[model samples]
Target: MSNRPYIVGNWKMHGTRAMLAEARAIDRAAERLIKVEVALAPPSTLIHACRKEANLIGIGAQDCHPADGGAHTGDISAAMLKDAGAGFTIVGHSERRADHGETNVLVKQKAEAAIEAGMGAIVCVGETEEDRDAGKAEATVGEQLKASLPEGEAAAANVTVAYEPVWAIGTGRTPTPEDIAIMHRNIRAQLVEVYGEAGQEIRILYGGSVKPENAVELLSADDVGGALVGGASLTAESFLGIIIAAAGDDAE
Candidate 1:
């Protein structure tokens, strides 16, 4: 709400209690900075535990089922996440899109469920380097955003969008800042079209290969609100550097 960059660390399949010690370390390292809003999405198994130990930081879940009631064994629903103290949920992550074969339509339903459950939805969208090289990245990502985002235009406060290039995720390679800027700017334009006036305020974070070293450049780029770190976020110091990098008004 403050226009501060909402930096979120996606601890994808990479945290245990000992790792939560690293989360606590993050709490300590970032305690003094009121400039950024930080959140961590751990494995769902750790959400409740994370909620208890969250302390000055926000805790999120990696995924959720579309239905409030379901027999989908091993699937946690949005209501369950809210009950577990998860303040947000990362929906349509690239891994979920690829591994689970989630379609934009399905992701839209899941996001609606999270919003109905009263938690923020970090909706993710991105394209492959191949798509970028072919100059179709913007078109592809724009289509995904059109399909996945709610048509009625949910409030910006309850939502954030993340651009996590499938090619860069976990590959240790990143898009050049210029490309990143163009894509993010494209995304903001699309959002403004879809959400009308409120979309300009929605946080649009850049994910993939986000580390302390590259975070400053990414955070400073136009339309890039923050980051969704994967590997670097496993540690406290690295993740804190990112949060600190995103400090201050993102709109600035």
Candidate 2:
């Protein structure tokens, strides 16, 4: 929303109390790297700890239950995440979609829930390698984005779109810049179609196997507002490298 590149780290199923030190260091570096917007989604157990350590960087949740309160066991809701100091939550990530069989409708509900709970939601939508090979990548992602995005004007303000190809995630395989640019352009068109001009303000983040080496080139891709880093974000050293890359782009 601030026009600063939104670089987020998804620490998925990682981090303990000991990892707070790295979070602190990342936060400190983020304070200095004012040109870029940095955030981290640590495990739920460490959300509060990371929040306490983060002064400039944002602390967020990897996922959240759509319900505010319920009998559901081992599920944290958007309200609970906000209470724990998470300013935002990632919904519809590839892992959740594949591992938990999450549907587009359910993902949309989750995004709406997060917005209702006064938190931001990063809605993820991407296709698999098979979809790409079949020439259905854009079509697949377009449908997912349309179904997964929350409704209303508030969505334009509270929602961020993350594109993470299923096959590329954790595989050290990445699409070419031309491919990423094309996908992002399609995504942007979809957003504009849904949210109108306000959609232009929503940041579209590129994810999956994002690291220091590829940060600059990836961020330079058309409509790539930032990145949703995975393993590269576990340590301050690697994560900061990506953040610095975003900052460098912002400077230009």
Best by TM-score: 2
**lDDT (tens digit, per residue) of candidate 2 on 34-53:** 89999999999999988888
Q: Give the TM-score of candidate 2.
A: 0.97
| TM-score, predicted candidate 1 vs. hidden true structure | 0.94
lDDT of 1 by residue, 55-152 (tens): 88889998889999868988999999999999889999989998999999999888888988889898999998789889899999999998998554
The superposed Cα distance between candidate 1 and the true structure at residue 105, in angstroms, equals 0.4
Per-model TM-score, in order, reads: 0.94, 0.97
Off by over 4 Å in 1: 153-155, 248-252
lDDT of 2 at 143: 94
Candidate 2: residue pairs that collide: none
lDDT of 2 at 175: 91
- Evaluated at residue 57, the lDDT of candidate 2 is 90
